[model samples]
Target: VEPYAALVLGPALLLALLGPRWWDRLLARRGKEHWDSYEALAADYLEALQGMPTLRATGAVGRVRERLERRSAALHRTTVAKLRVSLVDTGLTDLAVQGGTAAAVLVACSSAATGRTAATGTYLLLLLASECFRPVRDLSREWHAGYLGVSAADGITGLRTAEAAVPDRGTVAADWASAPEIRFEDVRFTHPGSGRPALDGVSFTAAAGRTTAVVGPSGAGKSTLLSLLLRQRDPDRGSLTVAGTATAAYTLASLRRGIAVVSQDTYLFHATIAENLRIARPAATDEQLRAAARTAGIDQEIARLPDGYATLVGERGATLSGGQRQRLALARALLADAPVLILDEATSAVDERGQARIVRELAAAGRGRTCVVVAHRLDAVRHADHIVVLDAGRVAATGDHTTLLAGGGVYASLVAAGRTAQEERAA
Candidate 1:
């Protein structure tokens, strides 16, 4: 009877102790699968939301909403199904442990009653059975909790994987003194999923300590050309050299350290004014901060804020007017003090009075630095030492603004059109 008791009780105890580990692994596997599905659905939803403005503008919001709603409903159904399966597995595991203990107890009681086992022996057997099943029950409960944890981990992994697929440039070295001159040698680029190339065999040299303005019609690849210089995307063919070195030779961080950009869309973080300024040059002094603001013609406005430089600029600087945001962006670029500066419609948002002030300030700030300006307003580009006119993704004319205007090509027509529009508006 003693030997029989040990046989039934010892194996039952082992099953209870070991069962939980196996169940936990199974739960984790299932949870990871469910999490991957949920994350894929979530990614799709976020991508659709990002394009919400365009969808709404194009009158496709209803269709987008419907598709997202269907995805959400599917996710709900999957979550509920996983919960149901988990509940069933937990209940079955508990039943198996309890049933095994019950059988052991019955066998021990019969042995004691029949005088085949001592009362003490029966009590020990029961205690051992309970102890063995205790681990099983604890494991079942922990497995349930582990499912949630593993699911969360799986979701994070999916997000990281998706982010990894997005193209990222290599880091540039911190040394700026060895920066190379930027050159575009017959470079061409077409935006992702676009029908036509934005830039086509565009060749140009941006010499050190010189200013170049790219002038063109609305779709003439001016912005695209600048984007290539910024290394936003590599050209389809041809080579881009910086400082006598191909762009691929240096890290992206190294390449960008020598360049600063102030464009029509000036993004400001939802942070204090000082914090935003520090993004360009973390070591800038308070005096340097004030000087940059003053140079951009925004010192008076920033001074009026309740906290001065510490004032929080709301998301994307929504609290500031267009001219103020542009000036702030200029201040940020100025603080960077890179060797090359690109201003793409930097003064377009400002009023004529503000434009005049900013243009004058830029002329002074741009001394001894390479500058590239892209402007629809002829007044802005007219002062640039070299101007290149683009039409249909090609250089239609290249010369100073006066020279191009006198040549009677696309630049001349655009100037005439701009004048006519201004006169009509005045009337």
Candidate 2:
């Protein structure tokens, strides 16, 4: 008993001191994954906030709020449940160790009274027994922390499951010649959660070296057509071909490599201007970066910055104006140098002067590439060699701008609406 006391007391004290650290480490490791998941959710919410104006205008703010609330509640509930489990495990472990130590002391005292051991021996026995259980107590405490970590891991696993369900076409291919030509063969599409189709048997040949402009009203499926071309979503029925090959035959990577897109809602990483441009062409030289910026009419703004192209654009290019971001996106697409280009309302957010410059640049850029422009502005599509008008997800008309306007159908109405909207805004 005396010898045991000497062995147990020293090690027990040491373990008691070190035990909490192990627990803390386990908790930290487990919590890290959950923290990351929460961060991703935060980013999604932030992006939603950035589009608040649009959501409000479209009357989707309520739906957005509801979704946010639900997610937040779920996260909160998960955290609380994990905390409760950890607390219970830790509490039980502490109680068991303390209770066992108390009982051991009583037994040692009884042994000494009955002459089974001396008083000193009994005291030593009690101390030794308490010390022996110290490591077990430490282990119990660690288990609590481990459970906490496990809970965090569980949260992360759930988040990953959700992310997996989202459709993500992998990285685009880098080769150009191997790219496929895009074809819409009687393609029909209905948006997710929408009652009607956005495209109805839309057939078109968007071969290389020609520009095709889709002109239409607010909900005319112009954007949907471009989305299909980009392979963001597949058609509900009929096949889409690329370069004489079916889209389904090629990997998403190979299909997307054949095209580049610039939309009105341009997204920019929180990086330097040069870095942003380099995303389209990672190996591009500084000279090439400057050249692309100049072509996009954003060189002047970049020059004004203290770091020039190296200046950070902040989140989503919030530091820059809408026109600047649009131009930056244009520069990115140009630097990509894909065989096919898609400009979906690319100039909608730009001012009149910026729009004119983009139009001119696009015309020049469209000379030898297959360009598909979805424009709400009449002036943008007026010069297109071929114009396609869509109404209620169907091809309502197809011709040159002048011819379509003369036809005095849906196209004419859209043109009239544009003029009216412009005039009203001006007034």
Candidate 3:
């Protein structure tokens, strides 16, 4: 009786163990497919949310929704496939348990019929068989329940590992008070997933206590050069030095603290006007804030607002006009009082008159500081002490504005185009 029971249990256990292994293989493939679909859907959803205004304006919201629905339907199909596999897996486990129990009962009945064991022994065999299969049944159920959770855990782990690669803080020491002369020597940088380099062996010098303008056409790597100087990214095959020290040698906080930037797209938190200004200097007084705003030429406008400095800017400063937002960003950078000032398309939102006024204000604010101005509008940067023209990630020419214009190279071509655009706008 024992030998017959052993044979039945052995086969049942093997089937139970191997069945889930096969199911797990199927589940793994399904999970990977599901994850791919989920990721694509999430990316599309995020893009739509971020570009909702554009989609609405272009009347493409319906198209985007249709695409999302198609993605969702595909995801549903994959999920249903996984569920089917789970159901099949459960059925296999049930078959193993039921078969083992039936076999054990037959063995017990035969023992009693042949008088090989007492009735008590038969009952004990039934009880023992139930105990043997109990753990296996529970394991199978738990594995089925945890499959989704395990896949989700893998996603979380991947996110953490990616974030861990970028350090929030640095161990290097630095000094922010010293106005550094920025230098990029034979710098080369290629953005992720791009074949061409953003900066190709680019070399230049931006002197301390002077304005150096970076002028170029679109995708000429002007922004990339600034990003490297600010240490947002390190150059792939060159050195970037500030005040004669490698940019990477400074802590992220220290490096950022040494430079202030105002760009065309000013990001303002959904907070009070004063709160937004305070992001530059958290301990600045209201009087100090007013002074900085005055220098940026936005103080009068802010004063006229219903809530004045207490007014909420709404999401990304959408409550204010484009020019107003740019001025506010300029004021914030001024309040920062860093040794270096960067104005990347800072006057892009303003009119010609406004652009000239902001230029004057910036010239005043940037006195005795290293100023890096990145712009496509040549007129705005014509008075720069030095102008660097970039073309296809290389410095096509470098000199003061007058010299570059005289050279009749890439800089001249860009300036001529800018003038044509300005004239067309006037007409």
Error of 1 at 125 (Å): 3.7
lDDT of 2 by residue, 1-427 (tens): 5443344345444444444454555455445545555666697699798899999899998888888887677667656654654565465555555655665666676677778789888977877777777677767666665654564575677887764321554443435573245677788988878888888888766656767788777787878787776666777898886666665555577567667889889999999998999898899998888777777888888999999998999998999989889999998998888878888888888887778887887788667777888888888888887888887777788888889999999989888988998899899
Question: RMSD per prediction, one decimal?
Answer: 4.5, 6.6, 4.5
Clashes of each: 4, 2, 0
* Residue ranges of candidate 3 with Cα displaced over 4 Å: 1-21, 93-145, 153-155, 162-172, 190-197, 236-238
Highest lDDT scorer: 3
Clashes of 2: 2
Please identify model 2 stretches exceeding 4 Å from their true place. Answer: 1-89, 115-124, 146-155, 159-174, 178-180, 424-427
Off by over 4 Å in 1: 1-72, 114-124, 134-180, 192-195, 424-427
| Residue 367 Cα positional deviation in candidate 3, in Å, after optimal superposition | 2.3
Query: Which residue pairs come into collision in candidate 3?
Result: none
- In candidate 1, which residue pairs get closer than 3 Å at backbone N, Cα or C atoms, i.e. clash? 172-253, 172-254, 180-243, 181-243
Which lDDT tens digits does candidate 1 get at residues 1-427?
Answer: 3667666766655665565455555566667767766777888788887788899799998888888787787778777767767776766666667777888888888889999878888998888877877767777777678777878985577787764321455544535463235677888888889999888888877666667888888999988887777767778988887666776666777667778899999999999999998899999999999988988889999999999999999988978898888989989999999988899998888876777777878888888788888999887878887888888888777888778888998989989988988799889
Q: Judging by TM-score, tell me the better candidate of 1 and 3.
A: 1
